[model samples]
Target: MLKIGEVARRTGVSVRALRYYEEQGLLTPDRTPSGQRRYPEETVEVVLLFQRFYAAGLSSRAIAALLPCVNKGHPSTPQRHMLRTERDRLAARVEEMADTLHRLDQLITDADRRAGAAA
Candidate 1:
């Protein structure tokens, strides 16, 4: 078993973040007699996965719900439904971001044209 600090070093996550994961029920590290957290080698990969999920805008509760499906390698019906719902939400967010990018590009182009005219 690896110590908590080792897991944090390997995962590039802060020790506080690892503790928060435990508080959120996402990580469950074993405790030594002295009350220190000890993690398995696979925790590095799990923490990376958590990072990806967070980057994708998943809440801790959503991740907690999905963890079982991930561990089992096959989602049950409800889990599949949840996955689809989250996917659709992410797609919508992406579309909104694309629209914002397009607007920003237009503003930049218009500003460039105005500057050229002034020149």
Candidate 2:
């Protein structure tokens, strides 16, 4: 078993985030006699998964809803639908980013043309 600090360092997650995960029902850590949190080695992967889910724009509630299916290794139809919705959202975000990049490129090109004309 590892202490919470060690787990946080190993997983690159903050201690507060781990505590929040526990509060969110996403993680369950063993408690010491002194009331310190101790976690198994497997928890590092779970923390990483949480980080990935967060980075992918999943809300804590969505992640919580998805975790049971992951733990059970069987996604129900609704869970699959939730995942599809998230995927579509991500796709939309990517398109928005691409559009923003294209606009920035155009601005840069126009600035370059103006600079050339000035010279």
Best by TM-score: 1
TM-score for each candidate, following the candidate numbering: 0.87, 0.86
Cα miss at 92, model 2 (Å)? 0.9
What is the C-alpha local distance difference test score of candidate 2?
0.92
Best by lDDT: 1
Q: Model 1 misses residue 44 by how many Å?
A: 1.5
lDDT score for residue 86 of model 1 = 93
Q: After superposition, how far is residue 55 of candidate 1 from its true place, in Å?
A: 2.7
- Candidate 1 ranges beyond 4 A from true positions: none
Residues 2-90, candidate 2: write the lDDT tens digits.
99999899989999999999999999999999999999998998889899899988999999999977678799899999989998999
The alpha-carbon deviation from the true structure for residue 77 of candidate 1, after best TM-score superposition, in angstroms, is: 0.8
Query: Which residue pairs of candidate 2 clash?
Result: none
Q: For residue 14, what is the lDDT in candidate 2?
A: 90
Name every residue pair that clashes in candidate 1.
none
Residues 1-119 of candidate 1 have per-residue lDDT tens digits of: 99988998998999999999999999999999999999989989999999999999999999999999878879989999999999999999999999999999999999999999999
